[model samples]
Target: MHLARGAVFSLLLATGLALPGSEGSKHHANKARSAGYALKEPPLTTPWTDKVGTEPWPEYPRPLLQRSEWKNLNGVWKYQNASGLNAVQNPPFGQALAQDVLIPSCLESGLSGVQADWALYSWFSTSFEVSSSWKGEKVLLNFGAVDYEATVFVNGKKTGFHRGGYFRFALDVTEHLVFNKQNELLVFVHDPTDDGDYVIPIGKQTLRPSHIFYTPCSGIWQTVWLEAAPVNHITQLDIDGNMNGQVNITVHSSAKDAPAEAEVTVHKDGKVLATHNGPTNKPFQFTVPSPKLWSPNSPNLYNVTVKLDKDEVESYTGFRTISRGKVDGIERPLLNGEFIFMFGTLDQGYWPDGLYTPPTREAMVYDLQVLKKLGFNMVRKHIKVEPELFYQACDELGLLVIQDMPSLRPSQSKHVENCKSVPILPDEKQQAEFTRQLDVLVNQFKSFPSIATWVIYNEGWGQITDYYPEFGLTDRVRQLDPTRLVDSTTGWHDHGAGDFSDNHHYANPQCGTPFYSADSSPFDPSRIGFQGEFGGIGNNVSIEHLWKNQAAIDSINRTYEIDTTIEAWNYRSHILLGELEEQIRLFSCSGGVWTQTTDVEGEVNGLVTYDRRLARTDEKQWQADIKALYDAAAARSNATTATL
Candidate 1:
């Protein structure tokens, strides 16, 4: 009874160019899809869904390390579903798939144009001709992300396979590619969403989704594109900077054995500020004289370009520092050595239509803009890694980020049920796989200045509690990236490690003390505590905006203690923030994060509605209340500084 499809079209534009086999090439299709594609109606959808067009997320997928020449491969493509690994041992090859699916979207989402029944595996096939300009160059087939496992085939030749669901992967398809010809690109994805057989980090996804767990995001839920690069190209740029204005840049080149000089240039407003040349894969530093520091009040970023031989890539970084220091006799996280409280939201990145993916680039930007406009300064990206574009938006919008590593647990979470603490020691294979993914995550996301802290575990979801000063989880993360602050454990079962003694309370806010000092010391200023999560004020602002699934209904029914009216929700939220202000002044609380930014399916306690159409509170009053927390925090910080 609650659905709207104002400009939303129907679902499939199945008609397209054929590939290489079966009475011609049914695999290859025209990149320019006609405006005749159909759209399916979800329970509630964002306005940006209408603007997605046939080419969803046409913007460049990777903004941090961008190249000029690239093609977005996100549109209608041949598709089919399978259940077993043996069924997909041999790819469809030259054969045309019976059904059509919108590329870069999982089959379960309405945006995919084929929200078919649940399947363990899927097959996608498409064909494209490489630009003649890129004929002699190495063609890198890039996938923004594919959930679980993905095996790619080009021109019927098995090309490459990637295991992770959240991190990005690229394969040099130059060998499998037939130059100047229409090459058929096929992919097979297998996602065991919380299957008891697999222990991969599923975050909040569950096959049997309910109140807390969300609908599963399987297959390619992000952008798929192709970028031309040289054989000896710059693969990654590890960038870091500090308060002393010294910027470190490390270039990772494809041709590691071959000697090549990495030429790095730092610029602002099209003018060069600093430049350095060093050997590839080795870190080198340069001081930016009179550096324009980056902060939430003024987010300033300097662009940089790294060139190695015939390959060059563009990147950007913000100069800021995160350190632990005491304010008003309570330890706090200092932003650029000043205690700036992070009035944040617990942002679980989910969409009704796209699931794991946002509708458009502008849509993602709007989420960050919402925080910026409302006087909130941070977002704890809860247990899910977003595309680099999300981080780029945070960097540009001046919103600090506390990024959580995805957790591994299938059934009802003990942490969510408020059960007693019990460390989950995963199997050896699970440990190795999780560690591998964490390594990639730390290496991948370290470039952004907006990420103030790396939260390893949330609510002890898939954590081994006693992982301090020993082996496995916590120590490995610190070993990989020590530049940023690390929260070894978030909600409960705190292992006395990492930077923060984080706690979670429902509808009320409270702070905790630091755990384990560097030298077994009593009081260490290098540690602090914060409210990881609090305040789930549920108010369904509009019936038309609610997700009408059974799980959603059950979730609403179970909210026996929540206030559902707009006025009551606002009143409760305001009072909670006021209490948190006092906590910041008296307790060892650095800041507090509201339970959520927007409502997910079923769990309807959000500042904004699920479709992002309505705010439960009056915008002006909510902004004023949030701003007051920072003012109180500043006064406490100022008093502490005077004593120092």
Candidate 2:
């Protein structure tokens, strides 16, 4: 790790939020242990374990747009259930509360200290000392994410109101701050998982959380902090780099008339490569001489610095291109103008300790590291928008991402039963909210170079349109981000809207089946043919690691006829691997994604156990088979280019 990165980790440990004992940062390991808070119940933990104290995730949350002078607000805060009927509506802010809970981790999580049920409302209050340094500048209150809805108040004044749990938002709290004194910050949150009837886009969260659906995450599940910025600072920085060496930069000022011109400098290792000056909101184009393209093998990113009047922001971008192309008579996804095959596991991004959040920053990076070590080039982030640091880790570690918009509504029973896509007719209000949330999702993650595709919907999960065909939603995503490929729907009910035809196949273990085949012939050959999901071989590990023991085991047994014993599990996994290899060779699926990377709650169909233990398949053999698929794809690309 870099010295600066180590320093950040050390600081987080000192605050009792970050896990200690990371390599090169053991000096701060005892810091968390000193704070002393025992777990209420014995919990299943990942290999990376550290005693969480007052705060469990204290590191700077947003690495893409980081400010040196910022204060992490993730620590102990007074919390109380505001869901009780007639429970003191609109209570006075800044008042002391009885219960204490950890910030950033959701209330339902084991690490939060308050593993309360999913409530209609909850209140969080904390006090902080403002330094003399933040007098003149604006103190922007930033929340990495808040589930469903959040109403924030500072010093007894309403500072901001925000909706959507997956996207980051900020408020200029400069006016509400009590200068050089103790200030009070309070947040009220509410989340009705799936709007109680599958009307809202809930994305795998359920009140009863069973099978594929997991626990509901309400309240602040991500980081919250404060930063000093100018009154009219740069609000957003959008960067788009192409394989032709041209990069376009768009700077968004806080106010429309605030800044006329902004300067953008592109550099490599502190040396200036190119510079361009242009007006805000307009694309300023620059070119890097002999730009190094980003791919799974070589992920190169040029450092970028934007100066808009008094405010300056730092970012990075990689020069790459993506499209649908033909390889060996099969439609394939092309990266940087070359046909390449993608093989990855579906990463649900759920943890036993943190639930929706990772236990620590290192925990986030470890998941990607394991995937890369297993020789997979891509990961489909299934129905979850991870913290910015997760995406940044993917960029630095060289893993491609297919981001899915979290789905809403429909019971787990309905989703499981409706294997075919059922076109949903959403009301007017649902349409507006869905459009807004999708726009936020695209804009928030558009800058990451690792993201290769924007999945509009997953198997028509939470999809809504007036008519049978769903073309408008995919078109909206294209308009929001045209740089990446868009999968209209993955697995079932192809609308023929996006650039790929996706399929999902699973062997019925109940019939003692070894393999189930899927035909991609129904899809248009002009588009990329992808096996978005397949190969779910069940292997239930220990009882403690899963959500439920007998019930989950029985469910798996009923569905896939596989016994709970280790030997039986390993035998099926062996068979599944051979079937996977055969599918890659025989089918026209240019890309394939296994059922999952890790087991979740009731789902035992993952490469690794839920607590990230016990690999189901032999790692060496699996990697060799996947590598052969990649080698064949590359050879086809080379032969076709030579013929051209």
- Tell me the number of clashing residue pairs for each predicted model: 11, 7
User: How far in Å is the alpha carbon of 40 misplaced in model 1?
Assistant: 2.1
lDDT of 2: 0.72
TM accuracy, model 1: 0.90
Number of backbone clashes in candidate 2: 7
- Residue 460 shift from truth in candidate 2, angstroms: 2.3
Clashing pairs in 2: 17-55, 17-56, 198-409, 198-410, 201-408, 202-408, 203-407
For 1-644, candidate 2 gives per-residue lDDT tens digits of 11121121100001112323553322111123313234434246775544555556667677657666678777777788885423335855757765777777878877777777766688888777668788888788989999878888888888878989899999998888887788888888877775444366677887776567777788898988888887777888888888988987788888777558988888998799889889997667878788899888999998988887778878899999887776667677888878878888889998877888887887788778878877899999998999998998888988999998888664333333548644443567876787789899999989899999988777766665335435877788888888889988775556577888777766521110222334322546667767777667665444545554344444554334334565565566556555554544555556778778887776777766777655565566667767876875566566643221
lDDT of each residue in 7-124, candidate 1, tens digit only: 2212211112121111111122255674434667776798677776676666677877988878777788877887587656877889888777777776778887776555578888
